[model samples]
Target: MATATRRSATRTGRTTGRRRRWTAALGAVALLAGTAALAGPAHAMAAASAPVDFATHCVPPPIAGIPPIDGTTTAQITVDNAAPKVGDTVTVTYTVTKPAASNPVDLALPADIMTPTGKVALGGAQTGSVTVTGPKKNPPVPGKGSFPPFSMTGTFKVTAPGSITLAPGDYNIHTSYIMELDTPCTVITPPAPVSETVVATDVPGANERSIQLTTASGKPGDPVTVTGAKFAPLADITVAGRAGAAQTADRTTVKADAAGGFSAQLTVNDKATTGIVAYEGAAWSAEKGAGPAAYTVIDDTPAPPNSQKLNSSVKAGTLSMSQAGDTVALSAVDFGAGGASTGDLNTVTVKDFRGGPAGWSLTGKVTDFTGPGGKIDAGRLGWTPACTTKAGSPSTCVAGSAGVVGSAGATLASTPNGAVTGGEFTVGAKVTLNVPAYTAPGAYSGVLTLTLT
Candidate 1:
């Protein structure tokens, strides 16, 4: 008795859909009811044995199509083989079915092939010349006939440390009995196929990149900001030659006051002082793919000192003289009212230094004199003196000394001087001059500029 069933064929289906219909009645009868003679001393005998049908199937996993990732797929394949490395080895299961006439059996395998540059290099050949075999008993299903599995196996090894030029591929190869599993036969035979590919990371290609930052004038201690305009987000930054935190970035926004941009504050470190400075971006091929950018550093230092460099100033002015032959005559010297005249000699006396010179004193002999004398105060007077042909002249001042060679010097009788005027601060005392009968004549002058400072 043959049971009838329909075979469904759907191509391009990655998953399988199975349909089973059970028989409610086998046309069997109760031997007890129909029998007296049928059961005379009932002994049992074995019914016709239905051979087990091993199904044949072949399928492949989907290949990665995403361009950004460029990935591939892997699949697991099993077979009913007489010499299987794994799986049930006890019973040699077999399958029998008619091979489809249309769509000549297609042996699908992985497209991933390993080359010297390929992803895998196991040491075996680049292209596999593998053969798949099935069991010897290739019979039809139950209603058709009984048969054992068609088992055959091909063994190959993948050996490579780094991939010899190219690596050998890995696969779960199986013997295929390409037949319609949709058949109504008691055993469905599927197309057995082996598949595998080199699944490994190729030695990553070497990579690199850089970024640059600059100031209008690359001067030390100048405030300059380096923005990673060319770099994408998540780029590392270094500050003042000091390595910074990972990928310190800035935010982007369209708001009016939005602070959109990544910035690296560089204080211009001494180490980074190259007369030129730059902030750079480099190989950040992490997430996806991209190139690198570099920057140069500039140094600027020779600028003149600021106008506010020194904020204070000082000026000096005074009036003084030394003793001549025998008389002393005082003329305008450092006229600035900056200091005082004091000692066992005399206290500082402010006097008029305008319209004439200061007065001097007499020493050894009377000397010729000129210029009108005016009372600087009650004590000091303004006057000028000159040397005369004769000593002991009534109009001349005389000098007094120790009678020694140079000791017979002029003693200033009156040397014109004055107190501080126009915000002048006094310092030391004044020198005295003496008119001498033989004193030399010469115009001595000195500037006395006083300052509020």
Candidate 2:
């Protein structure tokens, strides 16, 4: 009886083991079916795991004339703040009406983050859209689980890009909705774009230095005022120009005020000619910038050789044989002018109206002589220099006056010629004829000339 019972138990165990193995295989098949239902098509599921194929996923149809979706669903988007400052946080809210019954919908917020020029992904852009899918349900009841009359809020932060600068202007944010997953039935709505203004505050230490002049024109030895701003604080400023008199200082130094402002006076160089000059000022240190002030330096010195004249008394004198070895007054030459005087006999005024203070002298001679009374001997004429006097009278005889006069017709008394001082000089002359006891004598005439050099 024990042996028979044992055989019967073994047969039952064998049958039960086979049944358990079959049940476990059925469960594996069910699990695979559930996974397939949860995921979409095989191709779409694979594509999601790889780098997005922008050609199909990102590209959208032309917005022109596309009919609006005829569903009960409606969407609204709102940003926490329309005008956001750089480096601030932004909150975007998306609200939707009841979604369609057949298709699962995806709410998308594509913050294009465009610039004024409508370029994307630039100018401090914290871009790319955020997608919120329908809520997960155990056995997703056809359209009941995550479909609309729903409100979804998403938050993103905007920060000034380290590589790009965010200009202060309007930046656009766009909103969209994906109606169906990986199907032609998907409807994307482009809502009215929202704009946010980016603003910046003032930064310190960005001021540049500049300078200006009080007047536009000046002359040598003339004073000029210079004003400057935006220089280094408490800096030593040096002003230089070409508008001062000869042997006069033209450069000056002054310390800038606490606010980096300064005003100073400088003279143009005395010898500066008539033209333009770049009057400049700068600080000793390079931290303080340089400023240039344009100035016109004019020549005020007048043209030379104001006035001159020649006078002679020999033209009115009488030549007679009775005056032998006796000296007579020939002529008195005088010079005085109303112009710049060097207070010395340093001028030899010329007929060309040019004069210099090089000290002048007078020379007398008989250039030529001929008349109805016949010509006198050329060797018989001589002259004596008179001392220069304010009263026009001889006070002292000029040096070399004696023995310096000679009978040379070309140049008479040149060696002993009188020196011109203070623009005035004069000379007296005498005539002597070698009258022999038997020589026939008649009236004779001759000419005398005086030159100033």
Top candidate when judged by lDDT against the true structure: 2
lDDT of 2 by residue, 1-453 (tens): 001112111111121100010000000001000000111121121111111111111212233223323333334343332333333233333343333322222322222110000111113333323221111111222321332243333222233322222111111111122211221112233212322222222223422454545543444677867666666677777765422111124577778889988888877764442111122244222133332232444334444577422211101111010111211222211223111111111111112111110122333344222223344344543333333323431122242253222235222112111111122233333333322232222222233333332
lDDT by candidate, in order shown: 0.21, 0.29
Q: Report the error of model 2 at residue 433, Å.
A: 4.1
Query: Which stretches of candidate 1 lie above 4 Å from their native place?
Result: 1-210, 214-217, 229-236, 239-261, 275-453
Give the clash count for each candidate.
84, 11
Question: Candidate 2: which stretches are off by over 4 Å?
Answer: 1-218, 221-355, 367-376, 391-400, 403-422, 433-437
lDDT tens digits, residue span 1-453, model 1: 101121111111121111011111000010000100110010111111122222333222222121121112221222111111111111111122222111112433211110000011112222222221121122223321212222222212221112111111221112122211211111122212222222112223311111223322223455445443323344343332321112222212111112222455555444232211122233222221111111112222333556321112112222222211211123322233312221111112222111111122222211122222211121121122222212221122222232211122233233221111111111212333322222222222111111000
Output the worst ten-in-a-row residue range by lDDT, candidate 2.
24-33
